[model samples]
Target: MTETARTRYFLLAILLIALAAAWPELSQPGLLNTRGGGDSPFLLQRLQQLETAVLDGHFPVRWMPDANYGYGYPFYNFYAPLSIYITFLFRLIGFSFVRSIHLSHLLGYFVAGWGMFLLARRWFAHGGAGNGWAGLLAAAAYTVAPFHLVNVYVRGDSLAEFWAMAFYPLVILAADGLFGGGRRGVALFGLAYAGLILSHNISALIFSPFLLLYLLLRMRFLTKKQENYPQACTEQSRSISQITQIGFFKSYKNLRNLCNLRIANPIFGFLLALALAAWFFVPALAEQSLAQLDAVTSGYFYYSNHFLGTADQPLIQSTFFVDYGVVDREAFRMGLVQTAVSAAGL
Candidate 1:
């Protein structure tokens, strides 16, 4: 197929997957039931409050006056606010609170699928390794991946994290472009990384190392050096001093090549992302100690104590049945079909 036809076909597939994934919410417009227990209602309230605050000249939107029974709480100041901001925009464009939340969730799936397609296309197209079909399959596999469905259906209230997850592929693709010598790639990387950070701080923190490692792997080709001396060069063929001098020159040339724009661009992108997200992260870091941050990680919620395998539930049972409560511990198995397809791809 022509490039335009291929692009359109992939987009159509992404849209269909998005629609299917969000059918439950779309089918029942006013239904706001979620596995988040009371958290969903509180999130809705917070979004409404944030909208009002911004409209009423709250610049940073740090404090929520109605929270804590009107004593006020600095929730948004430390919390990731991009998802809420998107919901606010949806509300501004005449969507109801419930509809806005559902739409945001739906949009996350679409963006993630599209981003995965972009990355896979680039990966397969590199050195003519594969074709558009590979990218399409990848996009389908990622969109229908069980973890994404679980996030939307189970942890619906945590839209920020879901949004952050959606941006992961975009960040990878943009980083790939930056390392591949695309001039606009640095700006794209900065924007995507900033979006990921603004969506969820923890996801950004976890994914940053992976992004750096990917850049490092890609830079290897650029930094690799050819051995000027032959492998069979015996002591008789070349003097020790001459061999040392040749090795030194090769090393210096490799070092000089490594110092070029390809290596520097990705680093610049990372710095730019930090600069873009400074408004949220700077104050959040500065004032974190003042808040009851410990309370968040204390008691039953302690990270170290709640390992995944602690539960006695069987994998088969957990895989199919959706837990009504404690959705975090819900069956996390990607469906058999998805797993098989993924393995086939591998």
Candidate 2:
């Protein structure tokens, strides 16, 4: 197929998947009325507060007046803001709160699918191992993945995490491009990384190690020495000082001779992201003790209590039925067909 034809087909597929995923909310507006269950109701309440705060021209809205029974709390100071801002934009454009939330979910699926397609296509191109069809299938797999569905439909619909997940593929793709001599690659990577950071701090933290690994792998290729260093080293055993000198000179030589822009691209991107997100993170780190962070770490909602296999019921039972309570151990699950497809893909 022509490139345009392929693009059209891919878009159509994404639209179909998004529509299918959002059908429940679209068909029955009442379903959206409930926001989500459990802490989601609390999230919706916070979003309402955030919306009012933004609309009232509260710059860098840190304090939530409605929280803690009007005594106020620094909810926005630490919470990620990108998804909230997007939903606020939707509200500004005349969408109701419920509709805006649902639309965000739909958009998340679309963006994530597109990002996955771009990453897969770029990786395939670099490896010279597959074609566009591989990328398309990969995108499809990601868009309808069971965990993604569960997140959207079952698990309090944590829109912030969904937004972060949506940006993950884009960040990786931008990083790859930065290393591969693409135009404005550093800027693109910075924007994508910033988006990931703003969307969900926890997801950004989870992705950091993988991002570092990718940079290291790319650096290996970008800084490969052309000289026969092994032969030079084998010529004679050297003292510790001499070995240090050789290593320093080799590193300097690699930096000097590095023709590719890849080595500096990710570093620039990392610095730029830190700069962009400093406003939020700075207070978050400094004022952490003031918030009830301990409540989050250890309480009824403690992280330790939420692991898999901690549920009293069988995994199979919990996987199929939606939990009515707030603290179900496994709130997300893979559908039978999705599990089969995942296994096949594996």
Candidate 3:
């Protein structure tokens, strides 16, 4: 709300947008070129298909009629097409296809940082004396994170995956809001979870358990806080303790009693996500046998080589071509600064 806070956010956004295009494609308008530069090649065509589907009044828009050598491909049926659909919306607003692609990615980067800033704000500033500089640090760190850069620039893996991962923080933010015992974030959690699912099914699958775990952890914290508030308040006989609960944890009174907490907020959020994403996953699952899903269990996905490695051992040594002749093997790194800070925090 303050001018200083606005300035922090503006500066962070500018830095993130600049980072999105720092690579500078050799022969494309977007950040990444289409000359075998990850998935950029087919993304525009998908955009075109989405636009045609809209014009033809197809409700769900499953089949890509122009794909598969004129026989058509069921692209949208299995692959979540929300990101392409966003590009289509950009198309509707009179931007050229290339411009839409550029804007969509730039928006993804900006929104990702914005969401991180909000989460950081709540984390470092909630119920305490804090400043936006902490949020700026968090937002900037997230925006420049290496793996995220891979998703947006290097690998350009899937636009859907990028957006799915980008919005993941907002899901946690909503959960955090709910943990404080209010309906403030129920709708946001629902919509964000649904959109994440529709953005990329595999990512949704990967992120779902963590979301559940975070909800459970928050719930436990809330319950403990509420149950102990009375006892802590009754301790008026002693001086206020400071150093006993860690620097941040030294302030338990900040969380308050959370007396209005209902155990149903997270349940409602889960139900809403399921309801919204059922339209996509219901068919994706029920019709699984009809597709070549059996292939997922074999070949590259065979269990023998997929074991989670121990601390002394490295896991998978996988690599993917990110550009015409450029292969990226270290796409999974979280960056040195992030890794150090995260470990310190833990």
Q: Could you tell me which residue pairs clash in candidate 1? A: none
RMSD of 3: 10.1
Residue pairs clashing, model 2: none
Give per-residue lDDT, candidate 2, residue 246.
Answer: 62
276-301: candidate 2 lDDT, tens digit per residue: 88888889999888877886657765
lDDT, residue 282, candidate 2: 88
TM-score each candidate. 0.81, 0.79, 0.76
Error of 1 at 293 (Å): 1.1
Count clashes in each candidate, considering only residues at least 3 apart in sequence or on different chains: 0, 0, 0
**Alpha carbon lDDT of each predicted model:** 0.73, 0.69, 0.66
The reply for model 3, stretches above 4 Å from the true place, is 1-31, 34-38, 126-129, 180-182, 227-262, 296-298, 301-328, 334-346
Order of models, best TM-score first: 1, 2, 3
87: Cα error in model 1, Å: 1.6
- Top-lDDT structure, candidate number: 1
**Tens digit of lDDT per residue, candidate 1, span 1-346?**
6778768987998989888888887788664566645356766887888987888899779888788988888988888898889878889899998888888878888999899888888887863535566777777777767667766666557788788878999999998766543336668999999999999887797788898888887767545742221221222123233534767336534433433524546665777899999999999999988899888768865644534444553332233333334445544544455555557867
